[model samples]
Every structure is written in structure tokens, then in C-alpha cells.
Target: MNSEQRKFEIWRHKMVARQIVARGITDPGVIAAMETVPRHLFVSEALTDSAYGDFPLPIGEAQTISQPYIIAEMTQALELTGDERVLEIGTGSGYQAAVLAEIVFRVYTIERNNILFLRTRKLFDALKYHNIVARYSDGTLGWKEEAPFDAILVTAGGTQIPQPLLDQLAVGGRLVMPVGGLCSQELVRIEKKADKITTDNLGGCRFVKLIGEHGWKE
Candidate 1:
């Protein structure tokens, strides 16, 4: 690789080591996916230098691409085995979907913001991420046509986990999201078993509002 590519490679490795692994994210597939995706290409040219930093960056329309650790943590929580269909809410910069695509059989992602939807779709196409299927719609409603997903990930924070998403999750599936007040939320993971559903709080986090029919008002 050239100088710029080499620099980014080094930074990516360091990010995985210090930010992700150091924080106790131990999933091998998640680590590989996080290291493989080119996060810099998902941000504006002005923000490329900071793409690998341990923080979020604006991607326009009052949205932000989640930090690397958050992405890794959420993806790891899904416990993907590479043969499952995944649904992702809030495509944003498409970085999170790309990370999922790297480790899953396929990823169906939805975005409500039209501008972000179009931009991220083009980016996915240009990057040749064919395993990712993106749609422009209210993510909180979930994708019913593609229901019974093996795993679901909602990147935005909502007042509560949307009922539609829980309904669409396949039996024995896992859904990870942030739910709570407007400014902050508790990262929660919902597992749908045949007999009963279980919810676990992963931690506290902050994300842009999840606006839709079942979420925050627009």
C-alpha cells in the first residue's frame, strides 16, 4: 500500500488494540470486521483525519457516526456467526452497517434521513458492499417485509425499544439498542427466546434521536 493507506492501516490497528481490545471487547469476528472496514471513507474529507479517533463525528443532518468502540460493542453483543441475516437501524455514515456486513451473511439497514440514506447508499455501492441492502424509511418501525432477522441493531437512541423491532426479531434472536431519555440512554440487549424474552443493560450511551412512528416525534 501507499503512504496514506499505510498510515490508516497502522492507525486502524492501534485503534483496535487500545480502544476496543483494551476495553475488553474480545470477539474475534468483531475485531476483524472493525479492523477491516475503512472508517475514513465513511466521513467527510475534512474529518478523515479524525475517523480513527476514539469518538463520534458528524455525518450531516444532525446525525453522527458512532465511535469505534460502540460499534464493536454493539456488533459483538449480537453474537453473529456469519450465517445470519442482520437488520440495522439508522445507517448514518454506513460505517456500522459495513462492519456488520463484513461479519454477517447479509445486512438490511434503514435510514429515515433522506440525504443520509442517499449518501450512504452511494458509498456502499462505490465500496462494493453488495451484502448490505439499505432502505430510506423510519427505522423505528423496523423492516417487516424482512422480518424474523437473526440479529437486529439500532444505532440511534430511542425513548424505548420500538415494539415493531421486538416483534420482528426471530426466535432466539438478539436486538441491541440504546433506550432511555432524550439526551442519554442505557444500552440494552433484548434476546427473543421461544418461551420468553430477556433484556440486559449493556451500559450507558448517547445517540441521536430515533425518530419515527414508534419513536421520538419528528
Candidate 2:
């Protein structure tokens, strides 16, 4: 392998793959996507060393790049087939969007923080991820122009599922999010089929609050 490729492999294995993926992420597609995306490039240069670690790292602006395991787990839970249009509610560092770009047909990511939105757009450009469209907006509102997404992933915590997001999900689509109060949250997977919506609690997780009209009051 070439120098850069070799370096990425080492980083993935030692910092992300072995500890994160092997522990609970069973989906091959999720594993492959995470392995190929350069997580280090998504964070600040000062925290590059911890880029591939299993835990979340600060990315400034009171945000963090979600942990690799959580990313993989959420992606796997969606049961994506690589042909669906995915909507990401939080584009903290654009790392999740980059990973989704590797597997989905198109990725529409929304970031509430303007600084993170600009920084992530630059990262997407630098990495040549043309499939991802980044926007600075309230994530809880969902992207109305890009409604009827095949899959929606929310990266923050809320007391309840945002109704706008549920409305935006196409029939037979899936939405994964962490739902509950600030200190207590459970990862939930909502599936919409025809006119009915089914909900399943995956597990508990802690995440920053999702602030918006249909989300937590801020």
C-alpha cells in the first residue's frame, strides 16, 4: 500500500476498528464505511491524535464528533442498502456525513452552528465528497426542500421525536435518534410504513441537546 493509505489503515485498526467495531458493530457495510472514511480529517488538527479513538472528542463550538461506535451502530440500525437518500440532522464535524457519503446515494446534512457548517463544508470540499449537501439550519425542523428522505439520523438528544422529521421521512423509511431529557436519553429507531409508525428502543446514550422548534426548548 502507498504511504497515506498505510497510515490510514494503522489509524483505523489501532484507534477505531478493533476496539469500536469488533465490540458491537456487526454490520459489514458500517464497518467498511467507517474504515474508509478518514476520521482524523474531520476534527481540529490539535485533536488529530484522538480522532480515531472510540470516544467522542470536542470539535469546538460546544459540539463534538460522535463516537465511532455510536456512528457505526446508528448506521447499521438504519439497514441502508447504499441506494437511499439519507438525511443527517446534526453535522457537528461533518464526519458522519462523510461516512454516509461513502455508502448512500446522497446525504443531506444540517448543522445549527454556522461555524461548524462552514468548517464542515470546507472538509467536504477538500475530501471531494460531492454527494453530500451541507446546510446551516435548525436540525429539528428538518430540510423541507429535501423532504421524504429514505433515512434520517439525528445526532442529538430530544425529549420526543421531532414531528417535522417524522413527516419528512418517506414511507418505509427509518429514523434513528436519541430521545429523552438532557441527562437521560435512549437511542430510538422509528420506522414508518404506509400510514403507521413503529418505534423501538435500541439502547441508552448521552448526547448534547437538540435545540429547535420541535425539539427541546433552549
Candidate 3:
């Protein structure tokens, strides 16, 4: 690799070993995806050098790209098996969706911000992340026509788990999201079984509010 590529690789290696693996994010797929995807491409050039740091960074449109550890945590909780079709809300910088695209068969991502949506779409194409199909809409509504996804990931924090999302989950599918008040939130995962849904709090997290018909009003 060239000098620039080598620099990113070193940072990514340290990031995985310390911020991810040491923190107990042991999913091989999650680790692999995080390693392979060039996160610097997702953030502004000014913040590119700090892309692999242990914190979230602004990506414009008042949204932030989640910290690497949080991304790995949420992705691990989904437990993708490579054959699954995943739905992702809040495409943001499209980094998370690219990570998922590396592990799953297909990924349907939604972003409400028009600029971010268009920008991320081009970035995904240039990166050859063809498995990621993006849409611009109210993410809380989920994708109705694409219901029954094998896994669903909501990248933004909402007051509650949007009912429409729950309704779209396939039986035996898993959904991971952050839910709580305006300033802070807790990471939560929901599993849909034969006749019941199980919920768990992965831990605490913070994200921009999810605004839409079923989410916080604009």
C-alpha cells in the first residue's frame, strides 16, 4: 500500500485492537468489516486524519458518524450470517451501511437528509458497495415493500422504537437501535421469535434524534 493507505491501515489496526476487540466486540464479521472499510472516506477531509479515533465526528446536516466501537457493537448485536438481508435507518455518512454491506447479502438504507442522501449514494457507488441500496425518506416508517428483513439497524436515537420498524421485522429477525430521551439514549436490541419479541439494552449511547412521522417531529 502507498503511504496514505498505509497510514490508514495502521490507525485502523490500532482502532480494532484497542477500541473494538479489547472492549469485547468479538464478532469476526464485525471486526473484518470494520477493518476493510476505509472510514476516512466517509468523513470530511478536515476530519479524515481523526477518522479512526475513538469518538464520533460531524458529517454535516447536523448528523454525526457514530464512533467505531458503537458501530461494531450494534453490528455484532445483529449477528449477521452473510446470507441475511439487512435494513438500515439513518444512513448518515453511509459508513455504517458500507460496513453492513461487507457482511450481509443485501442492505437497504434510508436517509432523510436530501444532501446526505445524494452524497452517500455517490460515495457508495464509487466504493463499489453495490449491495447497499439507499433511499431518501422518513426512516422511522421503515421500508414497507421491503418488509421481513433478516435484520434491521437504526442508527439514530428515538423516543421509542418505532412501531413501523417492529412491524417490518421478519420472524426470527433482530433489530438494534438506540432509544431514550432527547439528550441521551440507550442501545437496545429486539429479537422477533415465533410469537413474541424479546428486548435487551446493550448499553448507553448518544445519537442525533430520529425525526419523522413516527419519530420526533421536525
Candidate 4:
């Protein structure tokens, strides 16, 4: 790798080890995807140095690219097997979807902010992530036409997991999101199995408010 790519690689290794694995995220595929996708490329040039740092970076439109550890945590919760279709809400920098695409067959991602939606779609194309489908719409509503996803991730924090999202989950599928009040939330995982839905908490996190018809008001 060239000098810049080499530096990024080193940072990623450090990031995965200290921020992710050290925190108990041990899923092989999730770790691989986090190491593969260049987080620096997903943020603005001015913030490249902080891309692999321990915090989230603003990507404009009041949205933020999630921290590396949270990304790893949420993806690990999905438990992708390299063949499942995944749906992602809040395509901020398209980083999360790119990471997911690396480990899953297909990713359907949506964003409410038009600017971010358009920019991220072009970035996905330039990155040659052909398996990631970007949509400019209300992410909180979920992608209904592409229902029955094997895994779904909502990047932004919302007051409640939208009913439509829960309904669209395929049997034995997993949906991960931050569920709580307007500001802070607890990372949660909901699993659908044989008509029974089970839920668990993966600890706490904060995210840009998920805004749309079913989420916080614009």
C-alpha cells in the first residue's frame, strides 16, 4: 500500500484492537469489515486525521458518521453470514452501509437529508460498492418495498423502533438500533424468530436524531 493507505491501515488496526475488540466486540466478520472500509474516505478531508479516532465526526446536515466502535458493535449485533440482505437507515456518510456491504450480499440504505443522500450515493458508486443501494427518502419509515431483510441497522437514535421496521424483519432476522429519548439512547437488538420477537440491550449510545414521518420532526 502507498504511504497514506499504509497509515490508515495502522490506524485501523489500533482502532479495532483498542476501541472495538477491547470493548468485547469479537465477531470476525464485523471486525473484518471495519478494517476493510477506509473510514477516512467516508468523512470530509478536513476531518481525515480524526476518522479513526475514538469519536464520531460531523458529516454536515447535522449528521455524524458514527464512531468506529459503535459501528462494530451494531454490525456484530446483526450477525450477518455473507449471504443475507441488509437494510440500513441513516446513510450519513454511507460508511455504515459500506461496512455492511463488505460482509453481506446486499444493503438497502436510506437518508432523510437530501444533501447527504445525494453525496453518499455518488461516493458509493466511486467506491464501487455495487451491492449497496442508496435511497433518498425517510429512513425512519424503513424501506418497505424491500421488506424481509435478513438484517437491519438504524444508525440514528430514535424514541422508539418503528413498527414498520419490526414488521418487515424476516423470520430469524435481527434489527439493531438505539432506542430511548431525544438525546441519549440504549443500543438494542430485536430478533424475530418463528413469530416471536425477542429484544436485548447492547448498552448506551448517542446519535443524530432520526428524523422523518415516523421519527423526530424536522
Reference-based lDDT, each prediction = 0.94, 0.89, 0.95, 0.90
Residue-by-residue lDDT tens digits, candidate 4, 35-76: 889899999999999999999988988778888888888899
User: How well is each residue in 1-218 modelled by candidate 2, as lDDT tens digits?
Assistant: 99876876789866555766557777777788887898988888898777887799999998889888888888889999999999999999898888899999999999988999999999899999999999989999999998999999999999999889999999999999999888979999999999689999999999999989888877
What is the C-alpha local distance difference test score of candidate 1? 0.94
Per-prediction TM-score:
0.99, 0.95, 0.99, 0.97
Q: Is candidate 2 or 3 superior in lDDT?
A: 3
Worst 10 residues of 3 by lDDT: 201-210
RMSD (CA, angstroms), candidate 4:
1.0
Best candidate according to lDDT = 3
Show where candidate 2 strays beyond 4 Å: 1-5
Name the lDDT value of residue 31 in candidate 1: 96
Between the candidate structures 1 and 3, which one is better when assessed by lDDT? 3
Deviation in Å, model 3, residue 142 alpha carbon: 0.8
Candidate 4: segments with Cα more than 4 A from true spot: none
- Candidate 1 per-residue lDDT, tens place, 1-218, comes to 99999999999999999999999999999999988999999999999999999999998898999989999999999999999999999999999999999999999999998999999999999999999999999898899998989999999888888999999999999999999999899999999999999999999999989999999898
For model 1, the superposed segments whose C-alpha errors exceed 4 Å read none
